[model samples]
Target chain A: MLGGGFAEAVTPLNLLLCLTGVILGTVVGVLPGLGTAMAIALLVPVTFQLDPTGAFIMFAGVYFGGQFGGATTAILLNTPGQSSSMATAFEGFLMAKNRRAPQALATAVLGSFLASIVAVTLVVFFSPLMVNLAVGFGPPEYFALTVLAFLATSAVVTGDMLRGLSSLGIGLAVAMVGIDEQSGAVRFTLGSTQLLDGISVVVVTVGLLAIGEVLHVASRSRRAPATETVASGRPWLSRRDLSRSWRPWLRGTALGIPFGVIPAGGAEIPTFLSYGTEKSLSRRRGGGDEFDRGAIEGVAGPEAANNATTATSLVPLLGLGLPTSATAAIMLGAFQQYGMRPGPLLFTQESDLVWALLASLFIGSAMLLVLNLPFAPIWAKLLRIPRNYLYAGIVVFATLGVYTTRSAVFDVLLLYVIGALGFLLRRYGFPIAPVLIGVILGPLAETSLRRAMAMSQGDVGVLVDSPFAVALYSVLVLAVVVSLVLRARNRRRAA
Target chain B: MSASVHRTTPAGESPALGDGARSFWTGRSELFVGVLVIALGGFLLIRSAMMDVPSSVSFLGPRFFPVVVGTLLAVLGVALSVRTLLPRSAATADEAGGGDGSAVSSAESDSAEAGARSDWKPLLLTGATLAAHLALLQTAGWVIAGALLFWGVSCALGSGHKLRDLGISFVVSAAVQLAFSAGLGLPLPSGVLVGVF
Candidate 1:
């Protein structure tokens, strides 16, 4: 798997693909609504005929490319391409307004590149161990794992567990729409001939993420005009920015990897947690007033955390065959399409694919740094393009992609309907990620849980039987409780 | 656009959730979520009832999981509604509103401020252009459809010079033809324009 993988990835055609994909991904990433998920989704059909590994290499490039590219938008426009970069926006934008845009941009790029390299290194070493652990998992263990994933996601995805749980419940309901494997009974098809196979993952993912996001963008006004244009300074970080940022970068990286593996919400939690930690620590460091006003540490730490979490997320996806985010979930679908399962046995069964993917990530990370750090202005200009043409182009490409997927016009109709629903949800402020997560993992979770219960003879106690299961559930409960208590306290304090 | 006015005012103003709103579940949020929850719950309950439980499996069956999750959802939904409906202490309302001042707003629009209504001119125009592109792709082909999309968005962003727009429109579509069709080997739609190639 390794030799062939490397050879395939390094092929002239494939290298160009990786370069192009990373560049495109970064460009899209710099734009607020065009995320890595959308980029990958839009390109899926275009790359359908390429060798799967080559396709994946390009996809990987695009994923990190988006991360690298997001820093620019955060700094220049006060808008973050991904939620991971939200903290970056807080500080980077401040620096921009203060005319230190170049330095902020530099620090963000450096921090991201450094953190991503470290994350890739960790993924290379730690993935095998994860695979070993996953190899021992049974149906019961998998079931427990799914429950843990669901609970963690609920606790961390949103500020309110109740609302999050409500979302999760909706997702589960959506998941239950297909035919039951054991009983062979159709559950929620509602008798439509098209519904017999259940909702397509692509349809759901595209609907919830892309189309929804477009509508969300449509609901917002143009970004407020820049009140000031601080003179562009040297691109190099100042001595102070360098000194203040290193520790935060280290701290952010430390915080990122663990969350990457946890099922809750991947980078979102860590990014915020890292931000909060850096904020408190900055005060203790006697760095009095600058922290919230675009401290270099603020930009560095979260950007580092963001990239690290993104890279390490692959660990769980590749090792345990579990997806921790929307993008990973889609990648998981790609894996299944290639007739490969990404768990512990993946390394043993598909060593070439795994290693090549790992090596490609390293290569991709390097390419991302080179492309994003120096070329940020180009991406910023991309935002200046007209929206009318952009959305129109997307619609055209989207329909064509759908048509190519099955050469069916009916899919085109479905795409429009889904797009409309997506638009509505976005307008309503309903978080759409959960819906995609729901559609992707819903079937797997239900199937595994059902199988586990059957094996246990319907024992209610089986769920909490294992120590791991108990521990996982305890963490879940704690997360929910903590979120509630924090909210309550915050509310009370506000009063 | 007014620099003096912008400089004088703060970038972010506090959200104005009134202090008298006592419940954790506000009247409006409660009403909306309550109805949704109950409907979802009712749906699950009916669906679960229709499902057959396997006797051979004893406790485990298709109906068992659905029933449990559905009932929990319904019960929680009702509980939330009840808790929200009951009058709460003034202090709590004051507290909830005061915390996250930036998050709370006095305006009814504040509830959906982050994701609310906006001018739909661009949206409608883009939609119309997309509809046309998709509808006419086979007839007009990639050259015209693709050019229209690129130019449409450029126009939406406020570029008004006709010569500049047309030049860009042609350049953009030509590039798409070269990149997607020639380089990537993906075929652009062929219509009347296909004969030119």
Candidate 2:
């Protein structure tokens, strides 16, 4: 299966798409305001014509390549493109400031490449086990899983619990628009023929992530973006640099895997944790002012952690049909767009597509390394393009991407309305991920819970009867408790 | 008109923008959002209550999940309102070694760094452009509508050379039309150019 997957992925069409995705991801990653999620969102609609395997292959490239681009910007420009790259910017920028940008870029590329390869390799081996676990999942277990997905995503993504859940509420509300699938009752459609088909996931995602982002950036202060120049050199590692980075790369991978599987709000936690670990470890080793100075370990660790999570997060999305992050959520939408659900059963049913996607991850990561490593200085030049033209192009693509989905101008109009909501949400301090998550997962979650309830004659206790459901609830409770305790301890320290 | 970008400043500039800034609502957004959510929740609950249930066997009907979501949304709205009104501790303590980054000030800080003063001019311009694009999409078609959108947004974002931006926009839309049409087999509306392609 793996060998067949590799043969399919290496096809000219898939390879070209993979390259295109990698390049697009890197471009967005280097430029601020464009995130990996938004990049994927724009493509979800545009890639509507491609086979699922090819579309996913591109998505994976964008996912991996965005990190490389984000790290470059973080290092050279002192601005992390996404939250996942924040820790990378701290030490990465410092390294650039000290005239070590090439080394920093090199470390990031190597680290990201190694981390993704490690994580994807693990997927190649253990996905069957995950499939077996997923096959056992009844509706109740699935319901509990979605519940954990929502609570954990919100809890981890935002500072305020109320705001986080509120974001989810917004998504759930949007999802509830259109007809009830079971009852044949049109719920939120106020009487337009267009309203009958419920909002498309592509429309919702493109609106929020793409068009909404354009408006959000427009609303912000347009101060000139300042970035450090990527020093012109071959972005190759030195002997000491290689030795210093490999350990952190491995450590970051280890730290990142659990978070990716658990859906604890993408890579933000693990990246920070890896950075902290590297900082303290450096101190213990009595490295001289390396924390304040450009520490290679710092950039290496977090970049590795960030990319590792991007790779491993797919496990839950593919293996269990659960999305652990916004990108994964959008990808799940992409899967459903293809008239398929990604689960272990998918491995058996549509094994070709699933295995092909997995195989392309390897090729995609290698392509990212090759594309980003030597040409770090060139990709950095993308930032020099006026922010206006970049955003303007995004607006065009967002329109085209959405309009192409169903070829309906009405859908384009719906895109703008949702885009306005997206702009409003981002303008305020609301998290956008939950809205997308809710739109995609809300229907599935509702159905699963309803099915479980129906099977058990409306006994609420049935939700907790399964050991898997109980374990999911326990994990969720533990996460909440841990976060609360941490907050309290921090408050005491502050006082 | 130029100094209107700084809405807080006293010196007169763009009255159009000053009015927009006022109407758009600033500073009390949390309250606005809270109220909006509550109203939405109320609407949801009322709708679900009035919804026709199809009779079938073993359990909770379709209304059950809507009720749960609606009630929780209202509860969340109330929580948001209360939090906004009250002075809360530990909100400020989010940064001081909060153990897990996600546990305290992780993503909020990252996103907050991007948002500063709400500059309404560009946003309003972009919004108007979007409206125009939507209106033109069916009649003027994807090529023209897309070009207008691209050029208009570029203008909003501070590009001054109109003809250059328009040329580039046309080139972009045409290229997209050709690629999507030929390569992917998705037919973009040609509008006036219907038979030309």
Candidate 3:
């Protein structure tokens, strides 16, 4: 399976798409305030013309490239392009300031490469089991899973649970706007004919992530401090540095794999966990560990952990049709846009496409390593692009992208409206991930719930009749209990 | 807004009053959000009630989920508002020193920084520019509308190179229109240039 997939992915046309995606991803990732989510949102229109397999292959490249590119900016400028790379920015920036910039870049690139390989290999082997489990799910089980997703993301994605919940609620409200499928009753359209078909996820995603981000950044009065360019040399690691980094890389990979499998947010937690673990492990050594002073392990561990989680995050997306992060949520929307739902049936129905996409991840990771090592400095120069021009360009592209989809001006207007909401969400400290997830999952949850109810002849008890549904609900309850207990303990400690 | 700021403060402890007022406003923005959410919930409930589901549909009907969602929103809205209006000292203590406290404070400071010196001039200008582009898009053509948007955004962002920006905006918009409309075969509104291009 893997061999055939690799052969498909390595085709000349697919490889070129991969290159384009990685290059584009790196540029987006290097820019502060531009992210993988926004980049992918903007790319949806461009990919509409391509076959599903080719498009996904490009997306896989973009995802890997985005992560690697974010690490570059985090190291060079102390500005993380994505939240997952925040941990990397800690020691990475320190290393850059200490004139070990090349070594830090090398560690990040190599660590990410190594972890991607491990995580993708894990996905290839383990996704089948996940698909097998999912194949047995009934409507009740799926509804339970959706509930778990909603609860997990809203509860843990943001620091403030209320804000997260509010975001989720807003997303659900947005999701409810179209005509109800079962009853054929128009729900929230306000009698508008244009809205009879419902708000497109593409419009919502682009509006919230891209346009909203632009508006928020524009509203800021203060300019970011000018970044000092760090000098780069050949990206070669010394023997001792290599020896110190290997163990942490493995440890971080171990920590990150589970996080991707769970419906918990993104790689942020695992990366931080990896960093903390490396810090403690170094302290236990009680030697010249340099934990505070730009420890190589600090950079190595979190970089690997971040990449590992990113790779494995595809598991739930591919096998269970569950999205755990904002990017994954957008990817889910992308999958749906192609008229293919990514779940257990996907393996049997479109096994070639799925395998080829998985294979592209491996190919894209290898391309990223090759592209990033020698071109790290060149990519850093992207930072020098004028802020005004860059943002203005984004505005133009965003408008163009929104307009191209369905060629409707109403969508363009809706884009700005949603963008404004996005601005408020950001300003008010609401996590955007849960909102996107809610919008994507809301309809599915409703459908499953209704289907389950109909199946049981309106017997609510049937929702918990299945063992899988019971287990899922049990886990949801346990998650809430554990979080409450942990919060109480933290409050006690703080007091 | 500044008048509200002035009226909210009392006489004696002007400095303390200012700090308190700032925190009060910053801390209570969520109050407005909560109220807005409640309004949305009320609207949803009213709309769902007004929805005329066919008698042939399932017993559950379309209103069931919306009703549930609206109720949840209303409840959550009340909870959020109550949380905001509670005694600040306790809330601050709980939020400030906890494990996630750093995250909260950092985010607060970030918003504070953006809020403190927020120049609405640029924001409003950008909004106006977009509005103008929307109005002109069909009549003036993609080239003109896109150019205006680009130029207006650059100005709003405080770019000093006016002539250069205008020139570049034109080129950029023209290139985009050409690429998208001509190269990619995606039909952009020709507007005034309908015959020429």
Q: Considering every candidate listed, which one attains the maximal TM-score?
A: 3
For candidate 3, what is the DockQ? 0.32
Q: A1-495 in candidate 3: lDDT tens per residue?
A: 988898898999999999999999999888876778777888987788788989999999889888888889888888778777888888888888889889999999999999999999999999999999999898889999899999888875455677667778888888999888888889889889889888889988988887777777777775777476575678899999899889988998999988887877878788899999999888889844586688889999999998899889899999999997778889999998898888999999999999999999989999999999999989988888778788889889989988987888888889888988887776545677777888899999988999988888899998999898998899889988887777778778867
Chain A TM-scores, per candidate, are: 0.91, 0.97, 0.98
Residue A427, model 2: Cα distance from true site in angstroms: 1.6
User: Which stretches in model 2 have alpha-carbon errors above 4 Å?
Assistant: B1-26, B87-112, B193-197
Name the lDDT value of residue A463 in candidate 2. Answer: 93
Structural similarity to truth (TM-score) of each candidate: 0.81, 0.93, 0.94
lDDT of 2 at A258: 78
Model 1 bad stretches (over 4 Å):
A1-8, A221-234, A238-241, A292-294, B1-113, B118-197
> Candidate 2 docking: what grade?
acceptable
Candidate 2: TM-score?
A: 0.93
How many pairs in model 1 have backbone atoms within 3 A of each other, for residues 3 or more apart or on separate chains, i.e. clashes?
15
DockQ of 2: 0.37
What is candidate 3's CA lDDT for residue B23?
52
Over the true interface, candidate 3 deviates by an RMSD, in Å, of 4.5
Clashing pairs in 3: none
Model 2 per-residue lDDT tens digits across residues A1-495: 899999999999999999999999888877776778878888888787787889998998888888788788888888777778889988988888888999999999889888999999988877888988889888899899889888887765455566678888888988887878877777766677787778889899888878887887787667755855647666778899999999999999899877788777788889999999999999999994888788999999999999888888888888998888887888899898888988877888899988899999999999988888888878877877888889899988888888888888898898998888877666556677777778889998988988888888878899999898999899889989997887677677758
- On residues B1-197, what C-alpha lDDT tens digit does candidate 1 reach at each position? 01111123232121245444522323233345556666777788897777654455444566656666677668757754564455544322422322111100010112224433344666665556556656766678777876776666555544558568767777777777777767867676667876776
What's the lDDT of the predicted structure labeled candidate 2? 0.80
Docking class of 3: acceptable
Better of 1 and 2 by TM-score: 2
Q: For each candidate, what's the DockQ? A: 0.19, 0.37, 0.32
